[model samples]
Target: MGIFDVRKIDCHAHVLDPLRFPYAQGAAYRPSGQEIGTTDQFVEVLQCYGTEHVLLVQPNSGYGPDNSCMLDAIRRYPGIFKGVAIASLDADLSHLRDLRDQGIVGIALNPTFYGNDFYADSPALMEKLAELDMFVQIQVQHDQLLMFKPWIERIAVRVLIDHCGRPTPEQGLAQPGFSALLDLAETGRVHVKLSGYAKFAKTPYPFRDTLPFVRALVEAFGLDHCMWASDWPYLRAADRQDYGPLLKLLDTLFPDPADRDILLWQTPKRLFGFGA
Candidate 1:
């Protein structure tokens, strides 16, 4: 069967345009490598794989609150892209309502990329996000769960844990990150992407080392709230990876078509509010 028939939705992807959205001048940001950080490049790759839609996540490389490139992409190709913008705790989200109306549905909380202080809650930030009904996507190391749990609980918005909480594959299934993930699942207040395993794996291609941890996440969150991603451009290793192989790997993770459908299609559709 073709990858298009895979019924896929790439839950984590980024567009890097230093010209339009310059690198953050602040110490909190880092420059994305020259390769694997283009909106058009990502679109071409996604279309090649028959991804029905994609959630354009904000990468830490372009850490500033500005989302011009991301928003422009969605505006240019509305049918193919949905967006998740990232903002710091100090950001003024007053304009989010208009952005939300324009298909910007989520904001990322990147404590690991910025600093642990970014996860600290601001009543105004929470109030603005709640008003817009946006999802707050958190990218935190597994051990740092306690740092953001209280804020997560206080927010009325939907929560998405980036990259299975960026758990280390070597941690196996019993690490604090995984445990925190399970506990969060018990509350039914969060969703985790089955993406970015490449980032956490210790070995080379064929990152089978992550199988046990990936399996445990599936068991804990089930098929409904779990989704797949390519982490495309593959960031640091963009040259070594592409969307096709990532989809192939995801198929191995889910196996059964019904479960695969949820991971690849259904769950993201629900979580990201993709239109049928």
Candidate 2:
């Protein structure tokens, strides 16, 4: 069977229906034009791609801490979507439990967008997440992974690293941040998303410069600990990105059908409780 005909899980994407749920006050960036992926649009697009499940992440742009848009999508489409929210650093445990009940499976932190200092006090929230069996999804660039070195294991939660650590392709594989992410694989508690190559690739899509980094991640984390993501709507994107072409890249990356199954289906099902 072809890739699309096989069961696949998009472990990361977003639901930005600003028309129904307006952007938050002082929201950092406003996603306009092609960046807007309404809940309905997301469902229709994924349906066309035969993606059976998705994890909708809250974007810092337009929605900020107001996870109403994402939460609303989860509620509206019951089983099809799960969420990674953006509750503040020291959010209350009870509030987290409420979010969990509302289909939020984790928290999303963007050190790349807000910087390390903004998340300095995150350990408290980290501890709470572990207590509740929720994960923390982080987006960082360059050496920023080093900043989380101290806290990641201490809290002992399932950590999802976004966009291949958003590494600098010019830095080669040894760049400290990406290297730190590689090392975390040994801990058996970290997972990496193989998406967003366009976000950090100095070269354009197909993002050939990022190929070496992805191979290294797959080698280090293993296909069992790594999964596929689309960063749908390609928000804040450097170039135009769409679902089919991005999904088709899987064949090039993993020529073996067994390996493709592991990345696109097995890992997400095991890690995030996706699919039947």
Candidate 3:
């Protein structure tokens, strides 16, 4: 089969069903009243884009630490879905173990929401996650990378930094935080997701402006540590973003078939424990 023909995995996406799982009162943001990202719709989108597997990240808009929606989706669609949940640093081990038992492979920490010292404040929790062999999925502001570096270095668990460390195109590759991010990848424990290009891109679709950052990251981390994802339901940009084009970016960025396979399938399969 051709490389692009092989079904791929989307390492990041969220399925929100407000009717059944209402948004938390203090949610950071809410979906349009009329539109909800249901699992079935998300699955349809994945199928349309040749994605066979997905890692559902708990939406901060879902408010509190209730991961019922994401966990339920995993239970209902075993093999097709895996998840990363948001839990407080002080959460109990039993609760975390339960999440692991339910096919949650990682814990998500958003420093943008939880503050810069989230990792530092949760050393015990980080150790527990390491003990469980679960990875930490982190989303932090671009400048926070250096601050997070020491904690990431000391922690034994695997870490996947979201949104290419959320760097802006204007910042350039030499920006201290992004440089630190690239340096972290050398540790062999850091992985970066090639998602959220639109968030930091200075220009419109095709997002060619951000290609240099993607290329630099790939060069730094290599295919084994790099994975591609479509931040589906693209939130505010939903009307503007589509899955096919996003998936095709890898093909455009990585001309070699083997490199495409690693970014689209192999790396994620290994990192997230997806079945062959």
Candidate 4:
């Protein structure tokens, strides 16, 4: 572990391996040719950045609800990794209990990509998540934040917002989507990850355009309500990016050592209930 030896945990990360798992049949987008990310590969990313633990978020590429790869990582390294399952609103809930037991902390929901009619609050989906004691990880458009608000309040489990809510910089701090996210954070039950900035950037390189929006999230949610993710393999990213530069950008975003510690590790530990 490099400078990240300070008890850091990567709140959000993805494992993309099509050869081994095979992309979701006829999926919207598939990585051209990526190898399976085994436990060792994940560990290398963490160690290279000094991240001691990580929360594995299910990618939209493999929408099959087959979380075998994510589960394998957790099982192989019980203490260092945790998983978030990408669940289909159409699937059976019984399968969730075993995933929960296998260290799956939540369900990754992507309504926009999958074109689902059930908004976050759909009574049917809520019932399923509640049954297994899992949280809901949502990837909603910056405008859809309000749609999930009711569900967040009604669901017994915590709700995590993905990729800064994919906010547009023009929306600034007052964007209804970002505003709703702040409101959710105030409730203390919602968490947001400052991952996927690449998706929100307008131009190239640093995606510096999203700085104000990112800062607003950190300020509104505070360190405890926020977490960091590498969004590995740079999938669905608007621009080509490397993981090393991304980590450096994060260091710049949270310059203070304490804030960095919380964003990188401590808050994630508390959020996912992961051990140091």
State TM-scores per candidate: 0.89, 0.98, 0.94, 0.89
When 1 and 4 are scored with TM-score, the better candidate is: 1
Clashing pairs in 4: 9-265
- RMSD of model 1 against the true structure: 2.4
Clashing pairs in 1: none
- The number of the candidate with the highest lDDT is 2
Query: Model 2 segments beyond 4 Å from truth?
Result: none
Q: For residues 138-172, what per-residue lDDT tens digits would candidate 4 score against the true structure?
A: 88776876777777777676778888898777767
Q: Against the hidden true structure, what lDDT does model 2 obtain? A: 0.90
- lDDT (Cα, tens digit) per residue for candidate 2, span 107-215: 9889999999999888888889989999989999999989898799677887899999999999999999888999899889899999998999998778899999999
Native-referenced Cα lDDT, model 4: 0.75
Task: Give the poorly placed runs of model 1, Cα more than 4 Å off.
Answer: 26-34, 91-93, 122-124
* Candidate 2 RMSD computed on C-alpha atoms after optimal superposition onto the true structure: 1.0
Best by TM-score: 2
Which regions of candidate 4 fall more than 4 Å away from where they truly are?
Answer: 1-5, 34-39, 90-93, 116-121, 127-132
Per-residue alpha-carbon lDDT of candidate 1 for residues 1-276, written as tens digits (9 for 90 to 100) = 654576678888888877766776773545555543777877777767788788988776654677778888899889878888866566666667767877788778776765776555545576677766787787777577666666666666677888878777666677875777777776676888887876777776568887787788788888898888878766666337766777777656766788888788888888777875
- Compared with the true structure, all predictions reach lDDT values of 0.75, 0.90, 0.83, 0.75
What's the CA error at residue 240 for candidate 1, in Å?
1.9
